[model samples]
Target: MSGLVDKAKNYVAEKVANMEKPEACLSQVDFKGVNRECVTYGAKVSVKNPYNTAIPICEISYVLKSDARVIASGTIPDPGSIRGHETTVLDVPVKVAHSILVSLVKDIARDWDIDYQLDLGLTIDLPVIGNFTIPLSRKGEIKLPTLKDVFHKK
Candidate 1:
């Protein structure tokens, strides 16, 4: 069981590490012992803001891949007590910060792509999965597919 959990963790870590360069950076990731209690893990992602500033963050995501088919995971920002308010990664250029967030979500999906059926432990929900379809266009807009010619109806 522990071995399975470790394999899953490695799957996620490798996904992040393999992302296209200059857009994201991750390190200090640790997958602690796993059990029924919880799937504990810790790490930091240095997201490069659109302005090209490196924002380092410390986060822990709880993943219970063993209990449920779809695992739930979310990130918590630094308290800002140690790194100070200014250094907190969450505070940075808006677009760059957003890009970082988008990248994180994408990483999860990519990680889950591997050994998805075999593990059946990681489940990605709707909201998160929808994010995958959000296109990264320079125009900065998400165009919904048109079911009908609304413009012509009138």
Candidate 2:
């Protein structure tokens, strides 16, 4: 009886391992805008759902790091759902305080850009599988806006 139960557990584990799940990519990061207190940047995540129906997203958690320091970290609860058999683009806004950016002037002074690593977890409620998180990471440089660009009108 114990052996039969173990075999059933193994079967289920194998099935879950072979299941086709959603995939995500941190597509791009760019300068969003600047405010009085902080500068805002936007990260774009592209997610492709494989299921036949829409999957409800539980949360989108993100960590933005620079110079081995966490510049920003937060969770966006219940952003929405991913469409079935289609790709969805989600925008995550990251705000870094002026103080934080001031602390990294050395790196920025080189080329007027900041080097960053963005870590994101895309959590979704999968049928029968419960909640699953898709981990994604991206490393790149964000070019800072020049004084002219900031004051330029659209």
Candidate 3:
């Protein structure tokens, strides 16, 4: 009986390992807004759902870092769902206080840009599979607005 159970477990494990699952990608991150006290950015997350049924997104958690310091991190609760057989784009917003950006003066002073790493976790509920999290990371540089950009008229 124990041997039979072990075979069943092994079979299930193999099937689960071969199962078709959803995939995610971090498409882009760009400046969204800027104010006197804080600078805000939006990360575009593209999730592709292969299942016929829609999968509910539990949350999107993100961390934005610069110069080895975490400038911003937070969660977006109930962020919505990945559409069935379709790709959905979700935006994750991050805001760094001016004080935090100011702390990276050395890095920002070089070439007038900030080198950054953005980490993201996308959690979704899969039928009969519990919750699965797709982890993604992106590294790039963002140029801060120049004085001319701030003062330029559209």
Best by TM-score: 2
User: Candidate 1's residue-wise lDDT over 1-154, tens digit each?
Assistant: 9999999989877875664332333323333223334333333433333323332323322322212232333433442222212222222111112222233354345443211111101111112122111111111111111334223344
> How close to the true structure is residue 23 of candidate 1, measured as C-alpha lDDT?
31
Model 3 / residue 140 / CA error / Å: 0.3
Using all chains and alpha carbons, the TM-scores for the candidates as numbered come to 0.23, 0.93, 0.90
Per-residue lDDT for 145 in model 3? Answer: 73
Say which prediction, candidate 1 or candidate 3, comes out ahead on lDDT. 3
Q: Tell me the tens digit of each residue's lDDT in model 2 across 1-154.
A: 9999999999999999999999999999999888799888999999999988999999999999999999988999999999999999999998889899899999999999999999999999999899999999999999887887678777
Off by over 4 Å in 1: 1-23, 27-29, 33-36, 49-69, 77-154
Name every residue pair that clashes in candidate 1: 50-96, 70-123, 71-123
- Give the residue spans of candidate 3 off by over 4 A: 147-154
Q: Pick the candidate with the highest lDDT.
A: 2
Q: How far does residue 40 in candidate 1 sit from its true spot (Å)? A: 0.8
* Backbone Cα, N, C clashes tallied per candidate: 3, 0, 0
Global fold similarity of model 2 (TM-score): 0.93
Model 3 residue 87 lDDT? Answer: 93
